[model samples]
Target: MPSGLPSALYGWPGLCCIPLKRKNTDRCPASLASLIINHHEDSKAPQLALVASILGLAASLDWKAASNLNPFEKCMEDPDYEQLLKVVTLGLNRTLQPQKVIIVGAGIAGLTAAKVLSDAGHKVTILEADNRVGGRIFTFRDGKTGWIGELGAMRMPSSHRILHKLCRSLGLNLTQFMQYDENTWTEVNEVKLRNYVVEKMPEKLGYDLSHRERGHSPEDIYQMALNKAVKDLRTLGCKKAMKKFNRHTLLEYLLGEGNLTRPAVQLLGDVMSKEGFFYLSFAEALRAHSCLSDRLRYSRIVGGWDLLPRALLSSLSGPVLLNAPVVAITQGIHDVRVHISTSLQSRSLKVLTGDLVLVTASGPALQRITFSPPLTRRRQEALRALHYVAASKVFLSFRRPFWLEEHIEGGHSNTDRPARLIFYPAPDEGALLLASYTWSDAAAPFAGLSTDQALRVALKDVAALHGPVVFRLWDGTGVVKRWAEDPHSQGGFVVQPPSLGHGDEDYDWSFPYGRIYFAGEHTAHPHGWVETAVKSALRAAVKINKHWSRVPSPEKQAILHRLEHIHVSEDVQQQEESPEGHVFVEAIPQVQEHITVETITPGKGHVHVHHQNIPSHVHEKVFPDVHGHVHEKVFPEVHGHVHEKVFPEVHGHVHEKVFPEGHGHRHMHEKVFPEGHGHGHVHETVIPEGHGPLHPGGHRQMEPGSQRHRHMHSSCKGGGGT
Candidate 1:
């Protein structure tokens, strides 16, 4: 009846089954029913419908002729499906050759490099400065209230597939991070307003400012201006756009070429800068927006964002030494020696030598280490060319939800006050509040402030926001996070400036030195994102594997092919398609139960599945199991021969032997029509008035290993309703 199955099918974790929408329709193996039923544990009605629909499609394409042929086995015999199984099995069950590899820093980049190399049969060692693993993915929780504060990287966009893969491999679940919405609050120069009003207020504010704004909504103006600017520079693509915008700041762009009235600029500046708009490289900002502005539904780990890095660390076969910060690095033609020592015994150093090394630390942490023979001029310049900004977050736990009195939902409130913005936790998730989060230069003034002083400042601003009447309702119990103030990380993460040639003397400057490599966000193309960090790490591993690797398997070859071109193009992340991953193999169940089919009757177009439409010609076939139990299957008569088999009792799921190739062919080439425009990305939400603080960790905090950028990561899908 419906064109396809419900959206709930895709939401089911670990399944890559495609939806059969109106446009771009295609048929898959008819045996997907038996395959999914066998691999998938639960036999819900939707799954059965999915199976029946697939079979219906096959039947539409002449199912009777091939019904006995077993499309599942043929689909399994497909070469691509075989290749996928090879890699997935390798990814899950490979043993390395135990070559000594040293990874400096326990950040995502370093850990990723370690995981890839170790999985390929190498001995890996990770050295981290802090006692804990996740360098910037730190989660601050109030011991008493169980409130979670993502002080560093918080939300991830759907386009960030690499990070998503790591999360899935680590067995993590993602929940949407609804930061902005129509029910948000915004404070401009002490005038408090709701987001819903701001989104609809283009007409009331001005005759001078009202030159046919897009939707006459405040968000419309901002979005239109942004879209226009992005469209203008997008021709140059993301890379060149990065160079063009890198020369100017957001303030310059909005006034000079962005073309906004002074009043409009001021209005947007108050809100945008709080989201880390000022002084940030315009190209980086625009790049972040251009690539990810579409798919707007942002999400983070269910339990805690910190759990992802922890899972990564646990996936490693080697030792992850904590508090063992790498103090110095020495490189030779054949080997690398990394000098590491704990903070308690800084002077007592232990040297661990490896055939190859990957340095995932730099900026503040890099400056702390001594490099023998010195880093190349270009590398040193690249390091110096990188900019780091102070970012501070004050987490406030209140006795009660005061904003509810104002009919304000739990989101972020934008303000021009010193506090910048305040974010409330999700609904019924308790009353822990991210009282104040300031970025870049805005964070400077509050960086050294005491927790009480920061709380007072946040309260004053909150009072200024919701009203001074509510100051007494808040009980001050919270902690402040000033990442720049930390000794390990000088200032949040690195932001790229214009004309930065991130070259090194190592491996054509990209893979770094023959014995040593650089893998961090700053070292990668898209700055300030863990995605960039992970990409850099994998890139380094690819180079290392190329230099010294064991005998290659087909699975390893596929993985190599994947890692070789992980990032799209140097210019933009768009206009190019990513290589598809294990399309159907992993999504299907590996273990299939023994199958038994009974009497067959091909239902007519008007017949329900249980109703027998085609006359059944009963003929029975018996098979004996290991338990000596006989299974008799009855089928319809076709030209005096048994016509076809019917799928009958096999408990709640499918059995393997009935359709041997069930596990391999899981995906069908079908376009999905979500409630929005389609992309390989996620949904978009209304951000005009939503109030989630930046949990940015740019290609992470613009620096890979530590820190997040000032904005939340999002993907594009063409949804304008938000």
Candidate 2:
């Protein structure tokens, strides 16, 4: 038996080796020496002899070469022996200390966090309850249509910097987005509407229109009304707006205003209340409007919105273990150990331990996670306070452009019923694409339908707008997605109910968790849109960056000042009045010591006043000095025809004596000789023989300095000219 061996090692082991004293070599089994030599040469030898000899047992055994033996060299000399020793050492080390990390979900956020941690020199394992990535962003392809449709999160506007940056970093080619212009069509009361500018209508109806135009569609009109109402409320101040309109619904408020006709109100109510399903008070609607109005307009991604999440996933530098579900998170003082189960195996669990853990799942998923210490009441209350609105999208591709066929004389009438239509010509194809949005109750019918069933209903609606809708060619490339069903995303976006009351408290509630952060359309300020997404992500990133380093708030006041100044300048420019009124010009030449009376049309034919011996260069700078005193020099007699003019005499320039045909009632024409000069032209006061005066709104041809005695005349019809 090996010296110092435990009793357990010697008593019950199946394979045992005993060391016999050299003096009692006769008792040693003959196979012992042969076994050692054969095993060593066979490269399948047990390490007992090697280890024992290295520990000074060879000296007791009187082995001559034991001192010179190199255990590592001997092991390396044989491939099988080297691998066997390596396996044993690794097994021993693993038994002493193990490593593990737990990732919460398989969605984009969870996958992203896992990939980041794994890349940063940590052993990570992802626990995904779902079978696939891209939580709410789903792509569906119909075999019949041969086109792919994005059922969820379809659009990513150009302003999505993180997404765009990731795409660039991943070397992915992004497609340019098509503008939703005239090719778009909308349906109203089952009648096809076209050529409408929905965003501009509210302004024409005496309501203030702020925010970018959303074009002509029910969505645009709804958004416009909501936006205008919000601006009106904000102008009145938040406190006052809330106090005045908090109890009223949008329908009640609009009806009270009496700004909309009954039919229009009914149509809007059907679309916004019934179809949109947004049951919001006037205050809530205004808050939502204000939030969304601050964001950039909606836009679709190049290929689809899926490109963004995929790009983020492809850029991950670590391995992502798919189908691995996390069972538990066990944390110690210094490290956290995660228990995970793989789909391939059930009995044994894989453990990953790490220093820090990040949970990126949704609110509901966060609720499901069992924290060892448990979350505090504040965190729990926050999770409960945050509510998500159910959002669903239905996309259908038609065989051809059908709405274009049913058009009146000049395309479509703006005042008529069909004016509410929204249509946009498809990029790279002649097809027409129409998209519509509905809220709460309106979303119910389409929410439960499968992709095919949704397409059928949509096509039927489309057919009703365009006569028979004969072609019936649905590419079947339709997408139906219910965001409410997603475990990671319990709903599409954050929407406040009347009960919650419109305020920032709910938003402020979600931001207090330690190290753990929330981002996405729901957490976005002012709600769902590409701008909000980018802004929210940026704000989160900034918060993280600020936590890592001390950064001072920039001099934003300067920018604000500049913006204010620009607004002031714009207001001033917009207020510039058109020169519609008339006035007379009375030129008083100091040197000549005489006044020349000339009638000036405010916005019509020019009036000429002559001053002799004036330098041309000086007059060029001083002439047309109607900048200030023109308003005071009004001549009431020719006030309807004469506008206003002030001709400042040049210091050394001379004016021609002959009066032009259009020189209205030119009198007191004078000539002045230079102080030291001799003969100078005399003032004739001759109206070029036949020319009388400048017409109020007519054209006349005359040469002030020419001696041509004939006058070419024209009469004034109105007090203006072309």
Candidate 3:
């Protein structure tokens, strides 16, 4: 019967016929059917190919019947595979032109982008605000006992193939992260019951549930609520159905389309630890639900999740600069310039010019950095308004495996208390328990408290769940991590609140602008997952590779090359001190560029001026005395417009001034330059034509209208060089 089909499609002769659903008989065959054929032990059989051929033949016959039996169609229904395919392509592709790419923030997204781009021959440099690598992938390990706890992200769903594949490629070991166990406890409405028995009786738990929802578990009933929405998603497609039903919040969905009693919905929220998240968009909730359903198991790295980032760091061919926070980014006609504040004693501001710039900072961190020319109004509004949920975790180490004695190897206890969830890792996890895992409203209070105060609050909640004996078992060591309190990560993860609506366009702020690009989990669909971060990284890298040929011109490259050679010496002698021990040093740039000035007002004052674009044979040095005064002669051969600026009396303030040049004149200055003070004075000059070659008589060479050149001043005590 199947002789015309490819002979390579070998499978079991057994076949089950399925009746097609017919809506019309005009072009229908009397014997319309679908076949489910069993395959043999041969794994390479062309099963799907044969099925597609049969479907094609049926379509050629003008059959009016509909069939959803195509395995390819079922799998491709969602964009998950398409996204993963892009990630895999990025991971496998290694041929590309080498370009200078500067990635802001050394988080997972930044690291992944750097890894892929660097492997493809790009010279990538990662600038991290904090001293650590992993942004939200932090891990806390006890130094003495070797116990470990995840302060940020903990679990990895088995369905996250990209993350799993990355872990394997990085040679990291993985273990089952027992997300739930039958012996786990659920406490709600002052009543506690094991998870296995919670579904048996709802009335005893004070929940007035419906007849159909009575015997179903909270997870089951949640699926039941999504049944109609899922049907709409299947029939009307994701975009149309989401547009139709996503206007409702999770709370609204449960009350309206879910058709469940209020008590039942409330019970579901309590048992599922989603009380704080009910206000989020139902569409966002559904996306999260698809990733976290019971059908997909979870896993975690063996030692700690930080190993992944560390491995990525080790794999990079470029450097990762720690404690270097990027303060500003400017997009030029040819390249992008990133300004970073160094952690050195000089507190010097460094400018890194690259072919492409990828910003992987979190939403809050991105808000802090200044952008030249300004971002689009929509992107700025999205950055200002998009919501990031608060999350806090309290980890406690126990001297003994107390929960194991109760035959509970791993799982979590859901409760209506301040600690919405308590997770117990497996025995091999060194008895370190996530005593408190709270999100959104539940985490707000914890984020404001000190570690000791947070520990006390968490202990109180744990005692309520496990009785007073838990205090005795606690090993006197606890770690509290409030993601909102973290300077790098202002909040835990991003979520589209109901107020923001359910459209994915709200998060499109990460889209590329000019030569600058954006990445991070917040910028992608299914926010707050490591997989999302990886996918976003892949996307940014692919875009960069596609648009990488827009390299800077030869003149721009020369200026950028010269900028890298400009170095500031850290040697400065201390002079007379002020009564309050205030020291201030200001910087003036040679070219019309953006300069970020940082001041360190300690006790004394000294000034050292760095002369850039000078011949290798000649150098100019300027030194200021205790009176904060310097005498210098301006270059006589200067042919450019001279714009003099005076600085006000800066006692203890740090100021940044941007002198953007339109043609050859400074039409506008971002900040106010105070009138010249006789005590400490700084002047500004913009060289229109290129500076001529430098000689021993204090002349230097520089590009015309170059934004990459800057002249820095530091306090030095001596005299001037010839």
Number of the top-ranking candidate, with lDDT as the measure: 3
| Superposed model 1: Cα runs more than 4 Å off | 1-97, 202-210, 226-242, 290-295, 344-347, 405-407, 468-470, 500-509, 550-722
Model 3 agreement with the true structure over 1-722: per-residue lDDT tens digits: 35543211111110012112222211111111112222323443687456545745644431112114222123223355465555654553554445678889888999899888877767677778886789999999899889889998888875577888888888999988777666778888899887656744555677888788776666556656766775676788756666655567888998888777888888877877657768888777766665553323578999999999988887875656666677777544345667666544533445566767889998888887765434554567777876888899998878887888767777788888777889988877677889999888878768668788888888888888888789998878799988887888888998886545335434554457655788998887777799889888888887676555343445434544543232111112432223432222232222222222322111111112233331111111111212443231111112233232111122421222333223322322322112222312222111111121111111112222222323332111111100
Report the CA-based lDDT of candidate 3 relative to the real structure. Answer: 0.61
Query: What lDDT is obtained when candidate 1 is compared to the true structure?
Result: 0.52
Candidate 2 error regions (>4 Å): 1-127, 141-146, 157-179, 197-277, 281-298, 325-332, 337-351, 397-425, 429-439, 450-452, 475-479, 499-504, 507-517, 530-722
lDDT of 1 at 613: 23
Please identify which of the two predictions, 1 or 2, would achieve the higher TM-score against the true structure.
1
Question: lDDT per residue, candidate 1, 406-512, as tens digits?
Answer: 65555577777888878776666677778788777778768667878987888787777766655676765777888887766667766643443332111223535
RMSD of 2: 39.3
**How far is each candidate from the true structure, as Cα RMSD in Å?**
26.3, 39.3, 15.7
Winning candidate number (TM-score): 3
Better of 1 and 3 by lDDT: 3
lDDT per residue (tens digit) for residues 350-393 in model 2: 33444334454555656655442234444555567656777765
User: How many residue pairs clash in each candidate at the backbone level?
Assistant: 39, 42, 7
